[model samples]
Structure formats: structure tokens, C-alpha cells
Target: MKPTLRAALTSPFVVFTVFMLGKIYLSWFVIFESAFSWLPLLTGLPTVWAAFAPIELFARKRKLMLYMIVNVVFTSVYFAAIMYYKYFGVIVTYHALQQVGQVTEVKGSVFSLLHPYFLFIYTDIVLFGLLLTFRRTFRSWAVRGMTLNRAAAGLIFPLALMVSIFCMWTNRDSINEIKQAQHMGILNYELYAIFAKRSEPLLDESEITAEAIMKAKGLAANPSPNYWRAAEGKNIVVLQLEAFQNFLLGLSVDGQEITPNMNSLMKQNFYFPHIFQMVSQGNTSDAEYMLNTSFYVPPYGAAAQDYGDRALPSLPKEFRGIGYEALTFHTNDVVFWNREELYKALGFTRYYDKSFYGDADTVAFGASDEVLYDKTVTEMARLQGEGKRFYANIISMSGHHPFNLPDRKKKIELPDRFDDTLVGDYLTAQQYADYAIGQFIDKLKETGLWDQTVLFIYGDHMGLPIYSLSSKEHALMKDMLGRDYSYPDMLNIPLIIAGGGVTSPQVFPQIGGHVDFMPTIANLAGISLADHLHFGQDLLNTQHNLLPERYYLPSGSLINDTTIYVPGRGYADGVTYALPTGDGAMPSEDEYKRALELLHMSDSYVNQLPKHD
Candidate 1:
């Protein structure tokens, strides 16, 4: 073979291609499992080459070694994305890249998803290293006269760009990101997401005007509370449960209840079993942002990371306006997801995070819920003694992902069928978290604050990821749910509001999301948010509600009165499921339009908020 041809065959470009192909190949197997398509896999090539061509063309001989290093770095990104998507059901973005530093706290969950097969992407690097070490054996690459000229390498950029752009334009209509990733490949899908986000117009002042607020308020159903503000002047405590889904509320295996405390609480409170979580890329922090600000998460990123700098109009600020002190407590450090800045933007009077909670009783990520509630209640008692009404946002961390708690912390015993399974570990951890919550309630009653306080509890997001299960485990969960696990099942979380002053213990079957919490809670507190530019309506007053699920689900997936609509490639190709049941159906075209309109308005509203310090 000619020296130039042989040299080209052994170039770092070849190694980079091999690494990326392995990445796409391994990711495909991990996601769809045994699903094969050559064209889809081939499409990952042009974009990878396009990204590398410029870097290579501009660098000198000294940077030749750096090429292999860069190849490793880029391949690692896909490795991380594949591992994340296994449990998250969503792809990580460039925005998520900024938050990678925060993964140390949740390394437990990260390591759980990793497998030995994940190392396949690195095999090419090993091969390249071996070739370098044994240069004499590979004469084609080690030949002194085989050098790449700038003119010859210049051809790669145009060839790659043309192919990459063609892929993007052809797949522009692919709205379902999962399908898009499958069809266009990961490299192309990422480029597609970048343009999709950049093309979105910012929300303007007109979108948040008084007239807009009135129009949004008109969409709500008439108020039907037995007595409005029944618990006015009382303390408000909101518990954000980590990964606690609605199915676990009354779930029993072998006659052993999974969440006995919550099951009992649901009977005496307003239980909205149909409420779905609306968190975006931020996950738990997104839940907090939604509940406080009543805004949609940014189209492509976590609201906390994307909008933390803006002065947000929030539940805490509204409570402060009503002569109440507001504070939020979480077990994690304040710097995670830039929460210290986010809390300030949300108008929190004070935030008590990891430093305040200590390491008394630790969990997967931080301090245990047992310690969180204990410390919070102690502070609440101090405020109660001072005759002050407070609004407290408490975030629980015990039921986090990987759901593996020590044996001493576990309370529920699994049957023989569930031994050492993800489902079993989840139940044990959630049950213990519930037990801690039950303990907190008892402490409230013991301190005589139970009757004088109005409390709300909700899961931050879904517990079990649909994609994380083995066939046997999936079958077990399917048998328990009586159907295939789906978007509705994945996003459905328990929302319970209970206290002594909640005179009527009723079940509200209306569909809602995190967006609705601030409005609903405000209405129950005798504070009307009708004048504010909020995305959610009061569930208590609204006869029905429909909210879009952004981030975790497809962009167009939404929860309504009795169904969840998930777009396939786009609104044209989507699936719908009956609420609280996994039964499938064909959603009408009008439903599609409504879902689109809701998403557009939500995006517009958040974009319109004034940028702040």
C-alpha cells in the first residue's frame, strides 16, 4: 500500500471514528436492546468527523498526541449520557454538562447504572496505545515520511458538514427525542437540540401582563371550598418526597403494606392520586423551582440552572407579602445546582441546607429525612413560641435513586419473589422514609402544632425508571400495576394535603403538576394568586386541569383530566393513556392542539419573565 494511504488508515481520525461508533453501538444496545439498524448507526459518523476535522486541521505535530486525548474526552460524554439515560429516560444536554460537577453527591446512583460493558468505548484507546508502544510492528503509521498536509485534510470539513446538516434538516420534524436519537443518532440529535433551544424566542413582558393573568385565571374552575382560608394564620409545611410514586401509597406485597403512614394519611386528606411531577433536567431541584415559582422549566435545561439569576416571583415571596416568614430546608449543600443563588432568586428569607442539618443520620445523598424533620420541627417550635406564622419548604433525601439503605434503616421485608431486586430495595427505602414522615407527624402532634398547621406532601419525581428494569423485574412490576409501565406510570406521584383544619376529607381526581402547587396552596391559604403571571391553576377550584410534562418525557407529553398524551416522533404520531390506568387510546387532534397550545403558553410565560439581578 502507498505510504500516504497507509498513514491515513492509521490516523487518529480512524481511532476517533472507532470510539464514537462503539459509543453509538453500545448506547443503542443499552437503550433498545437487540434493536439493530445500520443507517441509524452510520449517521453518527459524519457529525463526529465534522467536529474533529477542524480541531485536527488547525493543530500542529505537537498536538497530534492531544487528538487521542480529545477522542477519549468526547467518547466519555456519550458514555455518561448512556448511563444517565438508563435511569432518567431523558438525554443529557450541553446545559447538563455544566452541572456535571454536582454528580459527586449522587455518585451512588451514578455508579449503580454503570456496567462492565460500558468500557467497550475505551477499547479503541487501548488499541491506539498498544500501536504507539509497539511502533515497529505497525510500520504504516510509524513511517517517518507519511505526514498529513493542510490541503488534503481540508476536504473533511465540507464533506462532514454537508452530511451533518443533511441529517439535521431531514430529522427536524422528529419531536419525540427518543425517536430522534434513534433515527438521527446521538451526535446529530445533540446538534438538533442545540438549534431547537436557540430558536425558541424569549418570553416577553406582554406575556406576563395583568391582562394575561386575568385570561389565565378565567381558565380555572369556580372555587368550591367549604370555607376559604380555613387554616389562615396557621403554619404551612410542605414535604417534597424523593422518588415516592402514587403506586407505592397503598401497595402491598404478601400482605405487608409499603407505605402505611401515607395510606392512612390519604384517607383523611385531599388525595390527588393523578398528580404528575413536572420536573425538567434539574430533577428534585426542578420540583422545588416549579412549586415555588409556578413556572415551566426552561425548554431544554433545568430552571434552577437556566433561570437562577432572574428575580423570580415565588410562593415564598407571596407568603412574605402576607405577613408570614418563609424558609426552605434541604439536606444537600446549597451550592448543588446553584441552589444558594436559586433560593435567593426565589425570595427565600432564609435557607437551611447541609450545614444546618449536620450528619446525624445520613442517607444516599445527604442527611436523612429523620434528621431533616427533627431539625425543622425544632425550629418551627421556636418560631411558634414567638407567635409567628411560617411557610416551611422541607426537602427529603432518604428515598433517592438506587434506593439502597442499610439493613438497620430498612423497615419492610420483601417476599422470596422480590429478594435483592430493585423493586424490593425501593420499597424498603420508601417505607423507611414514610416511617420517618410518620414520626414527624407524631412529633407535630406531640408539640401541639398539628392542629394549627396545614401540611402538604408530594414526590419529587418517579421512583422506578421504566428502562432500568430487567425482563423479570419489569414483568413483576407490570403484574403489580396490571399493565405495561408507561409515561403516566413513570410520572404519576402522590399529592396529599391534610391537617386538622381540612374539614372535608375528600379525593380529588383532577390531573395536575408541580406548576399547580403554588396556586393551589395559595388559594387554601386565603391568598389569591389571580393577579400573578402563574402557569398553574388552583386544583381545588378547578374542575379539571391539564399540564405539560417537560424534560423527562417528550416535549409534547401532557397530563389532562383523564389521559397522558406522549408524542411519538411529533404531535402527529403520539400515544395516549387513560388517567390512573395504563389503558391506551387515540387522543383526538383537538387534544393535540390543546397540548401544543399549553406548551407554547408555558414556554412563553417563563420566557417573558423580566431578567433580574
Candidate 2:
């Protein structure tokens, strides 16, 4: 080897720079599928040097140790971004730190997302550790020492820092997080997110009214609404199935039904096939919050963590106001997602959690779905005996992620190819969940509570993420869905309203989201939302809707009646994916502005609400 080239390669600064650049490029490739662009290089250089500058300037000794530490930290950030993108299909920021406590609970699902190649990000760190173990060998090849001159260091440090800051400032307005990360570089973007403040002005509560929200959403009021107060004075039962998606409604594999009970329920009641999920970082808890309050989550964190401390207007409060008792049932601990505070904020009269269900037949977090429904029914019957009109929420957790149902609980058989695959496991789990639901229904009928109550069933969020699927699983989903599984399919979940009010069977094809659940249920329960502040319209009476997405998708993504539009940098460079109906609709700037304004209004209104003592 040439002496000059060998010396440069042996230098710690050059060696560390090479490793960081390689990892950065790898992250770009994994996320965007194209890393050849010069943007990452241009933005990455200054950002990386900015971190190196201070140590290079002031540190006179132990330079190698500091560099290695910094390198490991940067590598960790890049690795986290890659893993998070694979799991959530969005860039990771410091805001995710709030969810670190939840990682251990869902470790199975977290590990399932790991690919063998992703571990390469840590190869250099391992080798460095080993080399450090044998100091003589490491020093033999390592450079003796090196440092930038005082004057040179002073100039380079500030210049590099300024360049990085400039990159972040220019692209700060980009609504699509991925595009912003690409332009400013992942390192610069992460740093900017930690230090930056929102520049937009918050709208006053007075300016945020139902008329303004309706106008922004482009939805008109229905004078003679169908099914209004149809289930008046009846009991309300809501079933929130975890990780359940619409594709499982009538799916069959090898002539075996995936969710036969739900299919039958759909045939005998009101089924909404076009409802999409609107959960944020809190996942299931976010679904509950949106369903009860009919409001969007915070811009940066989960609603439970950010807004649960306030006294929010919700469906439960609406019921409680009319002398009806309100309660919720979940097998998990109430503290898992700050749900204790959330339940209080939602105004539930009572909540039965792990303490009420016990640890028997445990599934993901606590008791299995069978136990949840079994115990919940007993309590429901008790409430009925008390002559109480009640609102009861039951959340099912057996079909959660990493869908590994216990063999004793498994209710379906899979083909050889389907065995041991993520998709197969998911189907088997859903089948078991369906069986549990069947048992719950039979119990309700025997107790005669079925005819006296209004049962509402819906999915909490998506189970399978498109980016996390393998090629084989992708092919399997294509065969099941009749095409490649897209964003629309991932976001779509079923909403079935049965018993009391829904006497006739029918399917509603209008587009809606969890945000619309509050008003829809209020209307059917013969409750008035006139004095209450809610952002959702009654889905049974609406044909036009605009659903703005967050957390899972980009910032500017919106769903209309015909298609889901995802913005790149803005409306012009954005793309539209067809819904189940396959409509070729175009996106407009006016619609994009309206979607954003609605979100801002929601945030403003919720923020201005008075906190509970």
C-alpha cells in the first residue's frame, strides 16, 4: 500500500468519517430506496463535522475515545430511524422518547421487524470494542496522534455548525417529514426537531366553531338524518378489536373462514366497509381518545400523554349527562398508556382493567379476549338488573401484533406455506378473536341483553404494516386482496352497528374515520351534541368527508371520499392512491390547505379547554 494513502486511512478522523458516511447512506437507502442523490452527502458532511468540531478543537487527549462514543451515538440514531421507518413508515424524532417505556411490552412485535442486514450498522462498533481489548495490536496500526491547529479549528467549527443550521432552517417548512429529512439530512433534522419551536400562530377557541370545522372539511349538514335517535334510551356496548383490519371481515384461506362471527354480524346489522383508522402514537389508546372526543391527536405526541390531564368533552360524558352510567373494560393495566388519566378526561363513570379481569388466560398484555368478554358480560348483566341505561366499552387484545396465538386457543388451520409466516399468524389470531366474540354474543343473547342494547364493533388500528412485510408475505397479501396491499387497505377497518337500532342489514360505503364515531353514536343514542363541542359529523347522515392523517403517514396526507392523497413536498409533487373503489381523483391546493386548517383548529380548541382540578 502507498505510505500516504495508508497514513490517511489510519487516521482516526478519516476512519470515523468514513464509517458515519457509510451508515448515513445505508439509512437513506433503506428508507427511500435511493441513496445516490447528492443531497444526503451535502447535508450530512456539515452535520457530521459539526459534532466532530468541538472535540477536535478543545480535546487534547483521549480523542479516539470521544470519537468512538460520538460515533456510537450517531449510529444509534440512524439505526433507530431505520427500524422505526420499517415499523411505522415514518421518520423517527425525539418525540418517540415518550414511548420508550412501551418498548418492553411489545418487544415481540419490535423484534419481529428486525431484518438480518439491519444489524450491520453495529459491525464497526463491535470491531472497535474487540480492538480495544488488545491495546498493543490496535495501537500498532492506529495513528500516534493528530489535532487541528487552533486557528483552523476555530474557523471550521463555526462554519460547519452554521451550514448545518442553514440546511435545517431552509427545509423546516416541509410538511412531509421524509422529504424534510432527506433535504436537511437525518442528523441535522433530528437536531433541529429537538431545538426548534412551532412558528404557526395558534387559533383562539372562539374562532374554532362547528361551522368553521364543517366548512373546512367540506361537509354539509343533513337536515333529515337517517337513524337519528333510533336506539334512544337503550344500552350502548362498544367493542374495540385490537389490530383488526377490514380485510379480515370476509376473508377465507383454504376454504376456512377467518372471521365467521364478524361476517355473520355484518350480514345481520349495519356494516361500514369504508371507515379508516385515525390513531397516532398511542395506537389503541389514541383510537379510544378519537372515538370518544372526535378530535385529532397532538401534533408531536400521543393524546393520552399530552392532553389526558384536561377535562375533554366526550361520548361518555354525553351519556353521563343524561343519567346513564358509563364504563370501559380492558385487560391491560390502566397505566400502560396513561389510560387512567385518559379515562378520567373522557368522563367514564367507572373502568374495569387488569384488577377486575385477573391474570387467567393471559394473552399479550393481560387476560385473553375470552376472559375479557366473559367477565365483562357478567358485569353488564349486573348493570341491567340495576335498571341502568349504560355505556360499556370492551377492548379485545388477543389479536395484537406478533400475532402468536397460543396453540390451545388457535381455531384455524393454515396451508404449509402459510405456517410460520407473519400473515398466517395474524389470520390464526383473528380467527381466535372471532371465536371469543361469538361466545360473547351467545352469552348476551342468553341474558336477553342483546335486544336491549346497541352493540358497536370496530377495529382499533392496523395489524400489518406494508413496509414490514417480506416478499412472500407481500405475494400472499396480493393474492388475498386481489392486488398489492396499499396505504388505503392498511388504514381501513370495519365498523358494525348491530342490535336495537339496526333492525335491517345493510352496508354503508361512505368514507369515515374514528373521529366521526362520537357524533354518529350520540345521534343514535338520542343524545344532543348541540351544547357540546365536537369536530366529527354523524357518519350515518354524511356522504362527503375529509380525514387528515398523522404519525403513521406524512403530515400533509389526507383521505377524501374517492382517494388517499400523500404529499411529497407540497400538492404538486404529491401522489394519490385509489381506495377500494379505484377512483382516479386529483388533489387540489385548496383541499390541502383546508385539511391542515382543520387539524390546527382542533389542536387549538383542545389546547384552550379548561383543565380539571
lDDT of each: 0.79, 0.88
Which 10-residue window in model 2 sums to the lowest lDDT?
139-148
In model 2, which regions exceed 4 Å deviation?
A: 136-159
Cα lDDT tens digits, model 2, 368-487, are 999998899999999999999899889999999999788999988888889768999999999999999999999999898998999999999999999888889999999888989988
Supply candidate 1's per-residue lDDT for 351.
Answer: 94
lDDT (C-alpha) at residue 77 in model 2: 94
List model 1 lDDT by residue over 1-613, tens digit each: 9877877766666656666777777777886566677865567777777777776677655454666666777677678778878878877667777667778877888888777778777787788778878875443442343444566568877987888788777877777777777777777777677776544554565554545543533363354654368668888889999999989988888788888999999998889988888887788999999999888887766778888888788999999999899999998889998898899889888999999998777887788888898888998989999998899999999999898897779887787888867887888899999999999999999887898899989998998888887787888888777898776787889999989568777998777889889988887788876667777877776766657676687777776676788888877778777865445566666666666555666667666567766
Model 2 steric clash pairs: none
- The candidate that wins on lDDT is 2
The deviation in Å at residue 71 for candidate 2 is 0.5
